[model samples]
Target chain A: MAPPKRSVPDSSANGGALSLPRQAGDQRRDPSDRAIAEACGRGEAWAMELIYHRYRRRVYGLASRIAGPEDADEVAQEAFVRILRGLPKFRGDAQLGTWIYRLAVNAALTHVTRRPRHTEGDEVLDNIPAAQTSARDPGLSARLERALVALPAGYRAVLVLHDIEGLSHEECATILECRVGTSKSQLHKARARMRELLGPALAAERKGE
Target chain B: MRCPQLQRLSSRFLDGDLGAERASAARGHLRDCERCQRAVAAEAEIVAAARSLPSSPEPAQGWDVLWGRVSARVAEEERADAARSAASLWWRENRSRLTLAVSAGAAFAFVLWGAPALPALGPGPLGLVPGSSSGGDQAVTEGGPERDGVGESLAERGARERAETDRQFREAVSELEVIIAEEQAFSDGARADAAGAELGAIRERVRGAKAARVALPDTAGRPSPRQDPVYEAYWEELATLQRAAVGVSDGEPGAGFRQDPAGRAPATGPVTGDDRGGDGPQGPGGARDSAGDGEGTR
Candidate 1:
């Protein structure tokens, strides 16, 4: 039988990083991810629905940013299929969230590699206004979004996971199935590439300063 | 370090990945080089812009619609898995029956492919009727003076081939009768009883086929041999009996069937009518008795 449900703090609500283990005292009663995963493994439809609801946001986010918004739906759906199908065999070696994130990231990366990169359809990224951009230089966000699209899928994946999703380098490493050092290097190169792409915007920002 | 070299280390330095010495050198260069300082600041801003990008873009078709797709895919996968499991279960239940069918098919194919070669190997016991002359040779001789060994008319060749096949089948049936009789001698179980009943049914059908074949008028001088329903039924019954007899001899249900009542290997030769009273199973009987009853009734 599944371990009895106990009160575990809901760190996701608190904007905690994706790897939410049972933590110090706070009251929010919900089933542990392992309990949910074990239930899903038993071919319980309700348990699968619960898992889909729980991780859908993070998975969709990974898909949109890494694969771009146009293909996010297809990519996220593929990831969920893999997750639910593999649930029965989901040995709890990794945290459920971490494992799901890995599957989602892998799905996104695979999608990008299999299809030609297209920067034109990502209207979501195009619409994002840089938080620090001056009113006079509104195109910075658009340029930044294009720069992300221009990077290779591997580099883009690191940036999306580590910078945008707020996953640590270790988590990025786990998801990408790369070394932590490799993750860091990819992030560095990704950011440098972004800077190179956004050179004109940066020059304007420096002038304004 | 020069400004260009310091700029190269800026990405690592921004992420705090530089070693202590390199980081200090980068810091020293950045303190004096304004261009390098602007480059690092720009790198930081790009990371900030990326972090500010919304994690989940509201899908153009909405969350509910996307969820619907996912839900359908999951159900499709579940159906596929269920189908696979069901197929596996069916295979497990019927493995022995399927093996019998496949083995029978392969054996029939082997027989069809190798049939023409049998006449070259000469005749065995059941190759001719007890009191009759060679029927196939007689048919060929009556057919014409227009024939060479290879130049025989198609009709004559088919008739001859058909007779050879029938003779070979009778010889095999005679051999199977001996094995089954010996098998029944040392075995008195339900399996042996079942085998006897099945063989009896086959003998009854064979008798019917023989009667039907005799009733048909020979329009082409000899039998057409184009379509023989008896051979089809004969093949099926032969295959079934062969499986049962082999099972008995293989020690599956009847270990005693492997040896005769005297603990000797049973005779492997075809049992003729006269020989049945001697080496065949003695006293109260099963398949052999039923076989005799079938022959007597005919």
Candidate 2:
């Protein structure tokens, strides 16, 4: 979908990010993500900052989940660098969000494989999503995080993309560079593994059912 | 398809690739097969459970560090790209001039490298013929072709050819004069006066041949018909050689000129020095001396 129609205030006209909020229907038209990307391609500081503002938490959060805390910062740095480099060629066939998510996924995966860090101390606790489990038992959320981390990269990636990220199998296949059949198979296997890991936590919920 | 094949294709079915008939067949099989139904439920449960996983927040310093590094990298790439485009523009503008310079340089190099061997490659003028200078004692080559082939122009070759003809006629006439002088020295008789008169005629032919100059090939190598003494030189040389031969054939040494009609060739191919009587058929300056002896008798 095309980006929301808000005017891209000229950084030079209002000194970029520090500029005041515009009133409704200011005559100036917003630059789409494609334009923002083109501006970033020109190495505009404001455009780069805009990209950071737009997807900072998601990209950083993705890096932390896939690569753990030790390499999260490195992974985020690498992803944004790649994203900026790739922006000029970013044909808007896929949502910019999907494209950024893929870059973050690849960056996190590459960082994990290169370093091979398997420490489960702080990362398992920190990898939990923010809003969904505030009302759930903290122990079960902790258990799910541990189970997710222990899964192999192929299975983990499929689960993360198709289930947790709410993407269809076709989108998972595109990001992971595999056939949709492979994505479906991996997702099934990942879920089966999750069932085994959360058997006790699930059994407690099943007893009430 | 069998149960196993259907199970394998189950993912594609869920992803909506299955045809209506196959989907209905699989749906019928699922209704009957308890094992397949349970697998489908399990797949749904796993998807729900995974969706329930929370999205954890990243570190606070992450975006700041990422932006810093990404901006630096983009800046560096832009600088490199700018340099590349500038170079591309320069090449696009100057391409034809560069190609022309390269072609001209190559041609110049080839000419310089090949210049030394040019004389051996040229179709040289008349002096190059084997017996062209048979009249003179010397080799008779005036300005010979140099390595550059600019050694002699067609005009110079013409001049050299004329000089050769003049020298030959002079030598033959000189031989006739010498033979006549010898006859006068030997005789206080009447025949001696006739030899003196013939000597004067031979001397006149020598004078005529000397005055005539020939034109040779023009720069384009075509022989120009513009008759600036070239025709006169040939005419005078031929007349001098014939007259000297006639005078010497009648002198005391006449037998040399009687060798053979074919051997009596004159001027351009005059007697090759021994023009005295009976020296040899191809004797130079020899055939005409014999004319001096016969002329003395007359």
Candidate 3:
């Protein structure tokens, strides 16, 4: 079917990830990941479009979580540029997706360092919004979101990559360029920090109030 | 493990990071301690809540806007890369020729402009004459002609005049040596030997001056033969040597030149007796004959 044009729908009005509307068997016709990477290295536009579509949600999500939603677009754009440029040197030692995550996380951390902000660790406990007591933990999601923003960059990265994104500590270490032991330690610390940030809310949830 | 230590492993337990032994130990601690159990539960809730947090709400403008931005940036970078590649290719192709051309140009410029200034500077600081630098500087600054508001510099004109003077001085010295050779009146015994020794030393200095003149680039300015200070000093010694060869004394006119009160010593520092003593064997004829031969060859 005309090789399913490398075009995105005008999804500007939509507030969600793009849905692939192409028919089945499209995967069979598509190039393998290595071939796509090779094409990207050759500066092929279609290959870049394919890679962007494949990883946009994950890259943007990682960037938004690590570098705040406001700076996500810029960080994600930079990450994609690095990914495409660095593909020529991609020796396939790691999965392309893992490699891409490594690049995105690096971009996000760089963005965070470039623009300093107040993290939860710096906030006084009295300043934390008291959790509403509810059996079903009614604003738990919303409260946790705010708390995530308050966490330090290091804690936030570990929490986001491990807890939120559901990556194994080994994968987290790979993406974060830390040892597995360090990743585990960071995750433990990150969870504790999250509990502290969500103190009243988590306490309420545990109590089933 | 104690409650406090096991409490630390609560996050690890939830993530299944604890080894079997630690996990079993942590479980045993959790079962017995209510506060620790509550902490572990809270940690679990926090992780679960985070995982439930919506996958970054798709950017409001969706992915198309990002694609547009990214693609535009990529295209710009590609153009820049192409331009750089072309420049690199050009440089690689022409690097050898470019290097050769630059080196040749530098060498030609040095020969044309730099070499001409060397003659005017004399022997520099290392010269035997203590005042050589100041003397050379004085000659350049004082002997320079008036510019007359033209393309030519005063220094260039001075250089040209000096070159002409040098050529004339060489010719005159050659004529003097020939005359001295014809006036063969070698003194007898010890006196002739002593004069011969001193003349040999003076001849060495003359030879050194002659070499300096030959080494000058063609563009170097020559001085007037009579006013050539370096040759003039050598001429004084030659006159002394000739007086000895003609058996003339300090009071007499020898080779049509009057002896200085200092007895034929050069006014400027030239070769001294200590420098010339016992350097080579010579009689008065040896000195005069060599001088005549030097002039003939010149």
- For every prediction, compared with the true complex, DockQ reads 0.15, 0.11, 0.14
lDDT of each: 0.55, 0.49, 0.55
- Which tens-of-lDDT digit does each residue in B1-298 have in candidate 3? 8987886777778867678899888888888888888788787777777777766667777789988988888778667556432222222222223222322322322322333334544433322122221122123323342232464443354344444544443443354344333333432235445444545565676677656544433223533333344434444544444443434445333233322322222222122111121011111111111111101110
Deviation of model 3 at A145, angstroms: 2.0
lDDT of 1 by residue, B245-295 (tens): 433333222122122222222233112111221112211101121121111
Full candidate order by DockQ, most accurate first: 1, 3, 2
Question: What lDDT would candidate 2 get against the real structure?
Answer: 0.49
Off by over 4 Å in 2: A1-29, A91-95, A117-138, A204-209, B1-42, B62-298
Q: Best-fitting candidate, measured by DockQ?
A: 1
Candidate 1 accuracy as lDDT: 0.55
Greater DockQ among 1 and 2 belongs to 1
RMSD of 3: 33.6
TM-score of 1: 0.50
Alpha carbon lDDT of residue B104, candidate 2? 34
- Chain A, model 2: TM: 0.72
Interface RMSD of each: 25.9, 36.8, 31.1
Best by TM-score: 3
DockQ of 1: 0.15
Clash counts per candidate, in order, are 0, 32, 12
